[model samples]
Target chain A: MNGYAGKILRINLSDHTYKTEELDKDKALKYIGGRGLGSRIMAEEVPPTVDAFDPENKVIIATGPLTGTPTPAGGRYMVVTKSPLTGTIASSNSGGFWGSELKFAGYDLLILEGKSPKPVNIFIEDDKITFKDAAHVWGKIVSETTSILAEEAPDKAKILCIGPGGENLSKISAVMNDINRAAGRSGVGAVVGSKNLKAIVVKGSSKPTIADSEKLKEVVKESRGKLKDNGVTGQGLPTYGTAVLVNIINEGGVFPTNNFQTTYFDKAENISGEHLAENFLIKRESCFACPIACGRYTKADEVEGGGPEYETIWAFGAACGVDDMKSVIKANFWCNEMGLDTISAGVTIAAAMELYQRGKITDADIDDGLSLKWGAGESLVEWVKKMGRRDGLIGDKMAEGSYRMATHFGMPEVAMAVKKQELPAYDPRGIRGQGLQYATSNRGGCHVRGYLISPEILGLPQKLDRFAIDGKAEWVKIFQDLTAFIDSAGLCLFTSFAIDGEGYANLTNAVLGTDFTQEDILEAGDRIWNLERDYNLKAGIDPSQDTLPKRLLKDPIPDGPSKGNVTRLEEMLPKYYEIRGWSEKGIPKAETLEKLGV
Target chain B: MKIKVRLFATLRENRGKELELSLQDKATPEDVIQELEIAKSDVAILLVNGRDGDFSQELRESDVVSIFPPVGGG
Candidate 1:
């Protein structure tokens, strides 16, 4: 049980019953932890045929072996369940002190099943687990819920709570941990809300055991040095935050603007990381055990202490043709408190704006007296709030996510999503491999699933030609596999820029007393990835779903270095399928499955 | 020839955030960096008028030159 809590808390809300099971050492060895373990248990326990909101569908909050340990960027935790949005196995991750606190509470994972007849919240203190009535806090915003819980809970308590968006089962809702950090995307929050679970409070006074603490300390010290030496993790991110990508992505000719109609945002600099640093940033924040501290705490007009990453900036700023950073910051604050996923909520609003502009919808279709203009930050913020509250017909339509929203308006192509999930900030045409990653990602359109932008734009691990499809399939496969391992290992993917696979392997060996090689870690990633895909396939996700939106396929970027370049996804996909050991239909072959032992 | 130059990330740490530079005729982005006293090796990507540009590419009047250090985030 070295580097593990050696317990799994399983709660069944159907009968108000709970049980603790010993951590299965063999299964832990096979799947590693975090995403890997969570996916394995989900596939085995929950059938794909079950609806995401079904009482049988389980939501698992899992921590990895390195979680709460001294490893750099070790604060991450994952929420895994069948997604209401994509109907696929979803693993949404978040960072703060919660995961570490959960580990300190002496459990590696918590699995919740069934829906309570009344709203309830779970509290964990050391070995004690209590279920309290959540009626008073059920309708509150995320931060408000946590504050209310603090009146009775200990001062050291950390909370993961759902706001009104999740309580109402909005498809774009997110689970907020530590008031701000989100286990965002894939509608994981709605699943929690469906079970009448308002929040999970954790307090622990003990640390998990580690096998080789001295070696772990030494390895972490060395890796921490590497993170400090690297330019991105060391200085740029800590100073400007992830929003720094505004100017860089725009300059690289890949910053998606106006709902992916173009690759450039003319006023990108106005909302750039430099702009945030110069005008809004009051201070920078860091997650537990993280050295980079890329979190931004800033003020936009009257709203202070709202921090936004790059994706939030794009989703609220340039993606909708809004150039006002203050409004974007204000919108971001609302999304966080209301437990909304900024990417899906903002991008859905962007699609709505496009429909409005194209004469597809008019004032009659929208709120009376509210003009849904491209740069109407005020209206955009209003729509986000409405969507969170599911206020009216318009808000109800928006709660269905971008895909269903566009379909209701008779324009599914403008959704800019894959498998019903909205795309993140990076447009595929500019970053060629990113398109493939978005289409083929297990949890739907996501950048972290496989961030090729690292090599294509940031020049990490050596720069590649952005325009070329050559070596891109190989590159995508490599990045996807690497990212899968990083996500599973409970380390932030940012660590990949400084510490390579070898560094991670060494760190894992020192902490967990495992002798896994770099190749072993990568193979584990491939295995976990295939497991998630297999679950999605069983859930009826068509292999054909592994493709990009037509906008990226048919329309050439109007102007940029990527101009005239449509994503050569077809040219690269077959090669990627070949490399991934999947058939033409994107299913894992028997040999591949046998090799991975999944 | 004169162009507005914007520095980003680590490059901005060494010098000012932005500058409007006056360069000799046929001066490349490399010449602009040299004028700023920045080592050519420090720049990872350079953009002229918001498109990818080479250090050796000749600059023109009113061109917008943007330079950045290596940065990675998602």
Candidate 2:
């Protein structure tokens, strides 16, 4: 238990009951931690046939060994559950002070089960965990509820909670920590609300017990130096945050303008990182133990909030066909305060905009006088407010998310999604690798799952020919497996840009008192990925679901660098199956599963 | 002949947004980058006239050249 809490906190909100279970060391070693541990626990305990919102379904909050340590960008945590949006297994990660805080509170994972008879909040101070009535703060937005909890709980306690978005049961709802950082994907927040739990606050003093403390300190220092020396992780990110990706991606003609209809956003620079840094950025923020502090604090006119990240900027900018910086900034702030997932909400609005432009929807069809025209700043800002409280005529449809909304309008092709989850910022027509990544990601259309853009665009590790689809399957698999390891290790994925697998193995070996080499650690990553795939299979999701949207496959980007290009998923699919040791249909083979010991 | 050379990310930090550079008719992207004093190692994606072009690809008159560094995350 040197590097872990070695215990799991189980909470049953049905009757306000709770218990602590000892975690097996063998299981921990095999699964590693964070998402791997969460998925393993979910696979073992939860029945595949149950509904995502069913009381029997559980939400697992997990942290890894490096959390609460001096490792660079190591302060991270993950939320694993059956996704309300995609009905797939969901593992969303977040960085802030929360994960380390949880580890210090003496728990590795918190498993929530059943539903509360009434609204409540979970409070943890050392070993004293109790339920506090949250009926009064229940309906307030995330920030208000957070401040209220801070006032009621210990002065130094950290709070992770939801807002009206979750309270109203929006599929795009997110769990907000430290006021803004989010485990913001796959409707995990809705699951938390279904349990009638509002927030969890923690205050503790226990540090992770490391096996080689002195060595860990040295490795941590060395890792920090690597981060400082890297450009993307060090200078670019800290200066412009993730928004720096806007102009560069736009120049590549992969910015996903107007809901993937085109691959270029003409006014990209208007809402780019350079613009934010020059006009609105008031401060730069970082998570616990992060050296590449990429979090930006912004103020525009009278509004101030955590700055819109690259994905959010693209979602409200090119995805919606808008490039007004102030409007996007306001939407970002409003989304955080409302506990709404910016990607889902902004993409959903963009989907509606496409419908309106194509004559599929009319003003009469829209409730109120709200216009959803492209490049209309007012519409984007208003939609975020409407979505938070599920207001007006668009409320129920918006709450259903983009895929269902597109289906209602008979334009599912324009949904710009895979597996019912809207795609991220990158337009796959230009960056072929990420298109494959979106199609194959277990958590649906997500970027972080397997960031193939690093090679195709960013050229990290090594650059690849973005136009070629020949070896992209192999590259995507490697990145996915590698990313899985980083997620489970409780370290930031950005670290990989600086250190190799051996560097990570050194840190793990020092912390966990294990002599495993880099290959051993990578094998665990492979195991974790296969376990997740296996869980999805058992949950009745077929491998045939591994595909891009029809628009990505059939329609060509009309102009720009990747003009007349469609995602070559057909060529990569069989290759990816071969690389993954899966059957041609993309299902994991029996031998592969057993090989992973899943 | 003149070519529009666009710099991005860190390249923009060293050089200005864009400069119309005078070059020989057979000038390649490499020649343009060298004229701008940009290190080849720093270049991730080089586009000529809005198409994927390598450093060795030949440039044309009035053709727009955009050079970018490797930028990842999300």
Candidate 3:
């Protein structure tokens, strides 16, 4: 109770009824918070056999103990539910002021259940909660929805809303906040939309009380100073944002280009962070108390929005073969406005382009006669809007995401996805461990949950050859579990680049008043990972689903520094299973579950 | 041989601004740092022709070298 708001607000959309539940200290201790808490609740409450879009499924928005506290990068939250895309437990953490505001509203988590008969939005102010009719705002874009809510609620409110994409139940839809920030993966927005829930607006006046306020202030001050002193956080990120990785990853021969067919891109420099900093960036932004301020507020021509970060740049630029910076930024803005996951949207479009090029599909197949061409930014933006509105054949096919889209085209392998979700920026063939991570990730092909690229590419902690398969399994397991802890702590994983596990442990201890050691934190992270895996397992996922795409496993990188390298996933996966205390088939062993108390 | 040496992020700030360093043939990355009067500890990543290189990595003529200070990362 010292760190938590000590309440969970449950809204049953079925009957338009709402109730508040006292926070359980036992659950908090076991699950910690954020993705951890959300996963635990979903596992215990929702049946594994339930369809993700069914009325029985629950969507949980959760904040950690550190969130809303005077801690650096504490303005974070997680959206967890069974994914309509992957049919697995989907937990996507996002950064914005919403999580902190929710914490300020005296609630640790918001759990929405059952399908509503009519569109509605939930508003929470301190201890007061209201369900408002969302008929007028139901079909609005994310930006418009937020604007309307802000006008109605004034400066005190923060809204997390979806756009037409979510209303149509597009599998790649996202929940957007602060206009551009998103809980952007795994179709959590679609699940919310399926329930006829439009958004959750929160305004809180209560300030959190800590047991050792002085100690927490000191720790926060020190942490902020450390972040400011660090080069990546203090300078690189603030100046260029994550788009800086375009050149770096391209140089490493791991930047996904043309839908993972190649590693390097000749036009990478055109979309590099330097290009963004030089052309578009007008200012830098930060989430509550964060010093890094990697958020880019930029303008280009007539378009103005949060400029595409590294992932979005790669997704729209290199992955889709469009190198025009303005076009990529435009695409990013469109996706944000439409409330689509840029990664999935870009990858799905990339797949469509490939199919078009291979004569698998044609412009005639599209309702608007839109051409699917690589580097065709205009058409790409048009398709993005179409997908959001479900306007045409291409839009309808793409709304289902790459896997289903590819299947419809009679070539499922062209999807470049693992377990239905498309891969992010990294080309797994060039980074062997990342392939394993993507293949085995509980959320289906997500990189953030456990970014091994820190060690494999950036050489944080220690340097490992990006092209090597040696000892990668242990590295992946270590990073995966530790990253799970960071995600649950409501802290950005970016801080781990310079800050060690001890730094995070210290912050957690200061915020929660829990004596958490580095080992204890790692164990907690492992427990969260196992819990997610268990959820996926019960959801019918097995070892077969935990495998990389054939292209990454069989086809080698055609050129560049990593030429001839294919992901040696087989070499690392068995060892990875052993390290995770799982069986040979990647199932969490009973002993492992017992050890983690899951 | 003259090569374009660009300092970025923290390194640029630490070194006052972006710098263009001229070096002799077969000069190592360390020599460029010395020429720029940058502390060895200030350089976190050294890129020669857009690939990771160490201080001992010899620079070639016309190499577009980029040196960055340690930045907090993900």
Q: Each candidate's root-mean-square deviation in Å?
A: 1.6, 1.5, 2.5
- Assess the local accuracy of residue B46 in candidate 3 as a C-alpha lDDT between 0 and 100: 73
Taking all chains together, each candidate's TM-score versus the true structure is 0.97, 0.97, 0.95
Regarding TM-score, does 2 or 3 come out ahead? 2
Ranking by lDDT: 1, 2, 3
lDDT of 2 at A118: 90
Taking chain A by itself, what TM-score does each prediction score?
0.99, 0.99, 0.98
- What is candidate 2's TM-score against the reference? 0.97
Q: Identify the candidate with maximal lDDT.
A: 1
**Per-model lDDT:** 0.87, 0.86, 0.84
Docking class of 1: medium
- RMSD of candidate 3 to the truth, in angstroms, is 2.5
In angstroms, the error of model 1 at A480 is 1.2
Candidate 3 docking classification = acceptable
Assess candidate 2 and give its lDDT.
0.86
In model 3 chain A, where is the ten-residue run with the lowest total lDDT?
A363-372
Which residue pairs clash in candidate 1? Answer: none
The whole-model C-alpha lDDT of candidate 3 against the native structure comes to 0.84
Top DockQ prediction, candidate number: 1
TM-score of 1: 0.97
Q: What is candidate 2's lDDT per residue for A1-598, written digit by digit as tens?
A: 9788888899999999899989888998888889999999999999876798899999999998888877889899999999889888998899999899999999999999999999999999878999999998998888899989999998789999988888788888898899999999998888898889899998878998889989888888888888777767867788788998898888888888888888888888899888888899999999998988899999988888786899999999989888899999998998898888999989999998998899877888776678888887777767887887888767667776898888888887778778889889988877888888899999899999888888887777777878899889888888888889889889988788888888898888889999878888778888888898888888888888999888889888898877888888888889998989899887889999898899
